[model samples]
Target: MSSDFYTTSILPFAGIIIKICRAYTDSQEDFEDYYQEVCLQIWRSREQFRGDSKWSTWIYRLSLNICLTLIKKKKNNRQHVVSEYQFVEDTEENQAFEDESLNQLYDAIKQLSEIDRAVILLYLEEKPNKDIAEIIGTTPNNIAVRVNRIKERLKKILDGKIN
Candidate 1:
């Protein structure tokens, strides 16, 4: 794929990259660094695209690989803790509390095995289990099974029932 093709296809997925990076990195600096690294990886791997899947699917797989690699490398050395964010403020009563819910969700996701989190993110994006499996190099049946387990585990963690 050409650079223009990669830019047009991958740039739109930057927000997803940011969300994944935020879940993996602690501080703003590390997040930015990781984000740039992801972009670089996407550029490097663009030529490997075969058009067998949607561009978004390809980008999602690329981003997941980059995030997992960075997490494994311990490249995010910052110690800051992010409190999470809300896309909107609908009411005054529980806005702050809602952010905590987001935080809890992210925390729970971060605690999952790297492959599991990638599955969850793709699932949340409404990707088919088969697509998720393809992205993570797993079987569709396995992806479905793991996703159910991950959801239940996330619920337990958010409810403070998981130690």
Candidate 2:
């Protein structure tokens, strides 16, 4: 990929990519892998963009699709490893959110179904229902309903009312 394209196109939307990938990944390694794969796919498919929607909307769809595909692939290749102990390293991304409430909200989001997770993320990003519908391949009304339901569910989860 050309640096010019990367700088102008991808860099501006890196936060969108990061949020979508982070939603699907449990560890920083998987997050990095997802982020890289999404970026690579975006570069590879740049020519396929027809400007049918906004660039950020396209990126949202692409990032979510890539993360979901990787997740399914990992599930299909699951292995059972019995180990006595495991170690995890704290990364900057993990520490990026210093607010405890923000961390709790993210944890609650992680508990949502894949599609619901995507819906909520886009909603939180303050994307309009029409834009979210386009990215999620749903009707605007459907997205509106889903967003309301997701917000209620998220509130319940955060309030310790539901798991």
Write down the RMSD of all candidates, one decimal each. 6.9, 2.6
Q: All candidates' TM-scores?
A: 0.75, 0.90
- Residue 151 in candidate 2 has what lDDT? 89
In TM-score terms, candidate 1 sits at 0.75
Residue pairs with colliding backbones in model 2 are none
Q: Model 2 — which ten-residue stretch has the worst lDDT?
A: 87-96
Number of backbone-clashing residue pairs for each candidate, in the order shown:
0, 0
Q: Model 1, range 73-138, lDDT digits (tens) per residue?
A: 774674665666724344543222256667667767878887778888788778899888888888
Q: lDDT values of the candidates?
A: 0.76, 0.90
Tell me the lDDT of model 2 at 88: 57
| Model number with the top TM-score | 2
Candidate 2's residue-wise lDDT over 85-144, tens digit each? Answer: 865556556743677677778778899999999999999899999999999998999999
Q: How accurate is candidate 2 locally (lDDT)?
A: 0.90
Candidate 2 wrongly placed segments (more than 4 Å): 84-96, 161-163
